[model samples]
Target: MTTSDDEEINPVTMLLLDQKDDDVSQPNNNSNIINIAEVVVPTAVEHQSYHLNSITSTLVIRQLPSQGLSFQLWPAATTFVKLLDSYTPSNTDPFSLTVTNAVTSVNCRQRLRILELGSGTGVVGIAASAILGADVTVTDLPHVLPNIEFNADVNKNVVGTRGGGVHVAALSWGKVEEMEGVGREYDMVIGSDVVYHDHLYEPLIQTLKYLLLGDGDGERVFLMAHLRRWKKESGFFKKAKKWFKVDVVHEDGPSGKSRTGVVVYRFARKDAVFR
Candidate 1:
């Protein structure tokens, strides 16, 4: 699984190659093996390289079957990275400037500890590490860890060059013990495209509650870039309102497509909530 300095590994090709190796060992009588390309939406792993704040980082991503939507590179992830990249500590930009000032002030001697929930392809986390000089941990499901780890490795040099660091881990929503094991608290929690599923709403809220309010550090906030796909997704916000005060920090419909919505929100715990 080692990649050379100039090369980036492709996730889909690696998976198909593994399947082919399996087929060679145990031949199936049924010749109709499913082509992953047809079943998966994107069908291929996209190698995306972004140059932000004079640092370049690359990510390998693929959409796999039955693994939910964690494989592909969504627009929300890209938007989140762009938002992070656009900020500087001296800038008057509201949201990004606020994040930069807060994190930098709190983490003066050491790098800021940032945990990205549902870090598909690890793009946003990697960018945050490289561009912002923060120590970022990218977390997702166990099945998604391999790709996330791979991308982290691929961009390790880039992050290191910027005096930042990256780590990858598996974090399932609503798992209190797992959350406790990962770390006590982070300067910030981030996610993108994680609000689609209706069933995940409550679990996601619980996870946020722990990360933001579980410990005594109520200063922490959840920064998220969400794509408004279905109307039902609004329920996530409604449920989150009970424990968190949510703010739409930024919003835009890219390329003038009014129907396509992308928003960046900041979530902080309510004053009355005592953990």
Candidate 2:
């Protein structure tokens, strides 16, 4: 089915929209579905370690790469980890342009509550918890929770030493009950490559609205690391901008043959973004 320019598919009411099951799962030219890695490790379990130079510790995460995209590491996730690892109370260059004051406030409190959507392997959330000494809840599909829990377990000591913690939960986007279960008590929301597919745009935006636009006291921000892979992705941003004032906080220039740079965006409510 051909989609008109003005048509915005309601991701919650209709997930597949006009596309059939097979077509929806098929590899379109700009589809974000990636499944090309072939791992030969034991039971196809791969372990990735992130060294936090600031804290002088390492966080180890397990990945089920054979399972699919949700089980492996992505480019944007690594970017977020590096940014968070470099983040400090005095040097907040990563969050310099956008939400700087809010981040500083949270850092001063040392009680930053973070909720990570689509936590996947849980590396980004786990790293944030340890680096900022914040309590973080990393969530994803129910089926994907085991791995996230595993990673959180392995890093308990690392985060515990820093006075931070990690919690694993299941949060499927666009699900009202699930979103309610996750709650909106977070000072910051984070994700990496969460804007890949077109169908996921509206639902993800719905959840973002529920978190960022609702009645809140302090500054609420969504810091997302994204690697722009397709021109069609502009529509998602266009739709998101209506409910949020998005800004580029940090940009990772392309290296080697990698032409696309990973960008970290800070999404805040229209009023909160300025304040």
Candidate 3:
């Protein structure tokens, strides 16, 4: 959903969440009934022309990628692409580089298990494994996995030629029951440009809590990149802080208009001593 920069409310956000679920006739959880309207305005950058261009000519693109972008954005069986004819290759994917920097700064080990949520094109996770040598598992919805797999398949070749591990799977963050006992918790969890809708905030947080490793050698750190929008209130970050010590470790902009172009958040489980 979108609005003119000056508008106080975004009708698009409300409309995006208003449609009834297609599976409504089937039995479902009551919690699923909550639509996007219940939450405050969503804070996310509209991808615009450049972000899509990053992958437009790469290989595959989605017809209507999840981001709020135009028809020039290509939708595909897996990865989405849009032409970035104007932007330099370095600026083509701002979010991807942000995640890469976070993983590198943390000194993630190549041998550790790593998980990535909403790995749209699998860029960050794959790059991390390639650079750090970590065994990576890239995940998204079942529908999104095939494309992630394709990306992983390509990365695996790059890494194997260089000696690294890359894997892909289907993961819906809030579906904890399905994800239980999959394996040991990951040492690092990475997400890029993922938080947008207010309705998904609680569920996304809950899912992270469930998957995080809290003890032993399995420490977990979650890093996310976002382009701040009005609906993305500080309160939302505060709400997440209750579960983990949240910090806006990095911020940069012209992501679009007056809004910050890219922001990096690092979160770790809060300790009692610190509190």
**Local accuracy by lDDT, each model:** 0.70, 0.76, 0.50
The top-ranked prediction according to TM-score is 2
Per-candidate TM-scores read 0.78, 0.81, 0.59
Model 2 pairs in collision: none
Model 3 lDDT per residue over 118-174, tens place: 776665566555544567887766766665665567445545533558787777667
Q: Going through the candidates in order, what is the number of backbone clashes in each? A: 0, 0, 18
Ranking by lDDT: 2, 1, 3
Best by lDDT: 2
- CA RMSD per model (angstroms): 12.0, 9.9, 12.4
Span of ten consecutive residues with least summed lDDT in model 1: 15-24
What is the C-alpha lDDT profile of model 1 across 141-247, one tens digit per residue?
A: 89898978887887777788778899888888999887877874588889997886678888899888888877576778888987665655667888899889888
lDDT of 2 at 245: 83
Q: How close is candidate 1 to the true structure, as a TM-score?
A: 0.78
1-275: candidate 2 lDDT, tens digit per residue: 55455444222222111222221122122112434476434446656667788788888767665577788777678778877777655664647434356555564646878899998899899988888778999999999999889889988988886799999989989999999998998878999978877899999999999999887543788999887665678889999999898988899887433455788998888876352
